[model samples]
Target: MKLGRLNHIGVATPSIADSIRYYREVMGATEITEPFDLPEQGVKVCFVSTPGETGVNEALHSALNGTQIELIEPLNSESPIAGFLAKNPAGGQHHLCYEVPDIAAARAWFEGLGKRILGSTRIGAHGTPIFFLHPKDMMGQLTEIMETPKAGH
Candidate 1:
């Protein structure tokens, strides 16, 4: 049940293109990954990396492992994010993802604590196992638990 890091903040967006523009122009984000579609998840997603500690050192940047903004747009009307956007047409923060050392152990630990797990663990956008914690159990913030990505990922 050991926690690794706050991986990313999930942002439900009606349009990935517009979101990317906002991140770049308004938030000063310069490290956004290209948007890609995940048909299984029914969402188009991208990662926007925040500028790390004030330094020009690439090595230090890697070490810092700055959290990312995971912009998510529905791939179709039936997508979960589409539902979220129904309530928030402008779109907004959806969930917070935290990395766990072991996905199974983390799930069990959460269950033992009476925290509802939203669904079965599955491969996530990061290419690692991940699951969601129910918003009702987390004071209304839907939370995501992800298995730490392997060393080279």
Candidate 2:
């Protein structure tokens, strides 16, 4: 299966608002999307577009190669990321999401290799099908595989 692109870096936070402030004031990131709840996932999510990667042409970087930082906050105590926040109250990087042409194929390939998939494919924040690969099988990082968005979103 072909890996498409690095979609976003998931960051688990106690407060998405606070994280937005830090990203704006400290990191000087200004393209943060509004935080929205994903009840099915028991979390609130926002995306921060990051520019200025070293060695990349700024024009092309902003136009086509920019990356996103997804800030995720638990909706309630029962949220899945609640435990992660409990372990690190300050919040931190949670997972890495990668784009794939076909999530179904990616899932089958991983399963064929005997890797554990966290759950059945579900609609993700990007409005695309996604699935998570267990950290143990993926070098200690929770990996999200998402189907590439259709043209025009």
lDDT of 2 at 39: 99
Clashing pairs in 1: none
Q: Which tens-of-lDDT digit does each residue in 67-148 have in candidate 1?
A: 8999999999999999999999999999999988899999999999999998788899999999999999998999999998
Candidate 2 per-residue C-alpha lDDT over 7-95 given as tens digits, one digit per residue, 9 for 90 to 100: 89999999999999999999999799999999999999999997756676866554346569999999999998999999999999999
List lDDT for all candidates, in order: 0.91, 0.91
Which pairs clash (backbone N, Cα, C closer than 3 Å) in model 2? none
Question: Candidate 1: misplaced stretches above 4 Å?
Answer: 54-64
Query: Could you tell me the TM-score of candidate 1?
Result: 0.90
Judge candidate 2 against the unseen true structure and give its global Cα lDDT, from 0 to 1. Answer: 0.91
What's the TM-score of each model vs. the native? 0.90, 0.92
